[model samples]
Target: TSQHFDTCLGCLACVTTCPSGVQYDKLISATRHQVTRNQERTFSDNVIRTLIFNLFPYPHRLRPLLVPLFIYQKLGLPKLVRKTGLLKKVFPRLAAMESILPKVTVDSFRDNLPEVIPAQGEKRYRVGVILGCVQRLLFSPVNEATVRVLTANGCEVVIPKSQGCCAALPEHQGQAEQAKALARQMIDSFENTGVDFVIINAAGCGHTLKEYGHILADDPDYREKAEKFAANVKDVQEFLASAGITAKLNPLIEGDLTIVYQDACHLLHGQKISLQPRQLLQQIPGVKLKEPVDAALCCGSAGVYNMLQPEIADELGVQKVENLLNTGAELIASSNPGCSLQIKKHLELQGKTVTLMHPIELLDYSIRGVKLLRK
Candidate 1:
């Protein structure tokens, strides 16, 4: 049972496909939590899981390592390691971790966004933004883009400085106690924000944020609060589409810009949001959206699945990239940080050079009239 559950991608694709409308995601989630409590693991498995749970959920903990990581990448050590294949031969898990490291920029070390940003025009809605752990640290630009896009749409954006991880990573991995603790912290962070909607740019974190009700159902004090919080949570794209985008958008590039939107499973299946993102993208001037062959397929970056199960993740990543490439689209619009990183790694592995951006990032460029640099 443990082995079988380990192989499941937890992408919730099955939940979307089931004709009977079975809630397999909930079932699997409950089962995984039970397994975590009952099952014993090998020492090595414990070590890796311990390392991941400790580091990935906390931004302050992850910040210290970035300087060294920046140095490592600046020295082109990753290229040398990949060329030698020493890391893969000796420690495949660590190799998996290294393979997804993005080109760290000076921007990665900065968190310059203010706690509150006013709307560009008359404010239509005030929304709180939840910056996921990896989303804020590694893909900080995406959060910035989200804020810009939201404010441009006549929405005041509030980022609770107290916010941390939404427990998406641990929740998916069946770390029940830790997930609950983090969920409580997330709810507390947004309690006093007084926003109309809590916006999340990352798909996985959005899904988890919306599930806080279920995650805290047993906690008598938080049950009602959790449900209220979950009710207000919205993916940034979802909110913009429903509330309507009022901002003027310019062409992102000179010519017709073709893009294929990669569906992060959490947004596509978990939240039933396949259309909202594309709708927002198409509204941009001179943008053309293309459909991939397997548009609903997972990119193997289901949270930390790529890091934990590298072999299966590599195969899925390769297949996903191939499908996206087959569309003949010039750029890929990825809404989740994990998907962006996993897709990036496989693109490098296959020696392909297609550009990838978060949907919000593209929207930001359009709103600000900044031309996209296309290769």
Candidate 2:
């Protein structure tokens, strides 16, 4: 039963496909939490869980490792290890960790965005952007692009420096107490920002943010506040789609660019936001969106599932990459960091390369009148 539950991807595709409107996501979450409390995990499982819980949710903790990671990748050590097959043979979980290591950049080491970013032209809304834990550190460019796009669309973006993890990782994995604590801290951080909406670029974090109400419903102190916070939370794409595009979108490339928008499971199934991202992308001049086969299937990056269940995640990742590539798109647009990393790793493994970027990043380039170099 534990194995059966562990293997479930928690993609919530069942929820969407169900005719009876079953809340399978909630059921799975509750079951995972119960398993954590009652079941005894193996020694290896405990170690992996401890490592993930301690490091992934804290930017400060993750930042220190980037320098070493950068050096490791720069030296081509990751490739060497893959060729040797030593790590995967010995410690598969650690091998999984190494597999999705993104190429670290200078932006990975800094938090350069200002606390208050003034809107271009007339401001239509004042919003707070949540710079998620892995997002702020690993995919800082996404956060940067998100801010630029939001500001270009006439939003005064406020990023509270005090904001930390949204606890999506813990929350998804059923570390209930830790998740609750982080959710409380998240609420406290943004409570005084006075922004009309709290925006999240990463789908996982956005889904978790939108569930603050349910997550904290039992807390007497935070029940009402969490509900209010959850009410105002919006995925960046969702907000932009609803608000409508005010900024002019220039052609990203000289000719029509065929791009595939990979739907992160959390955004599509968890938040019920399938059309908004496609609508926003189609607004860009000379941009064409392509649909992949099994577009709604999980990429198997259900939060940290890729790290914990590497073999199964890898199979799903390969299928997802194939589907995306079958679209013959020049670029792939993804909204979630975990999905991006998971797909990227599999793409690399297959000795194939495609330009994968956050939808917001592509939008940022279009709004800024920058053209992507393409063959």
Per-model TM values vs. the true structure: 0.98, 0.99
- Candidate that scores best on lDDT: 2
Model 1 quality (TM-score): 0.98
In candidate 1, residue 164 scores what lDDT?
Answer: 88
lDDT tens digits, residue span 3-120, model 2: 7788888888998999999899889889999988988999999999999999999999999999999888889898899889999999998999888988998889998899999999
Put down candidate 1 lDDT per residue, 1-375, tens digits, no spaces.
Answer: 777887899999999999999999889899999988988988877888999999989999998899999999988898899999999988888899999988788887888899999999899999999888888888888888889889888998898898888999889989999999999999999999899999998889989899999999999999999999999999989998999988888999998999999999999999999899999999999999999998888999898888889999999999999999999999999999899999998888888999999988988999899998889
Supply every candidate's count of residue pairs whose N, Cα or C atoms clash at under 3 angstroms: 0, 0
lDDT of 1 at 252: 94
lDDT of each: 0.91, 0.92
Candidate 2 TM-score to native: 0.99
lDDT measured at residue 7 in model 1 versus the true structure, 0 to 100: 82
Q: How well does candidate 2 score on lDDT at residue 344?
A: 93
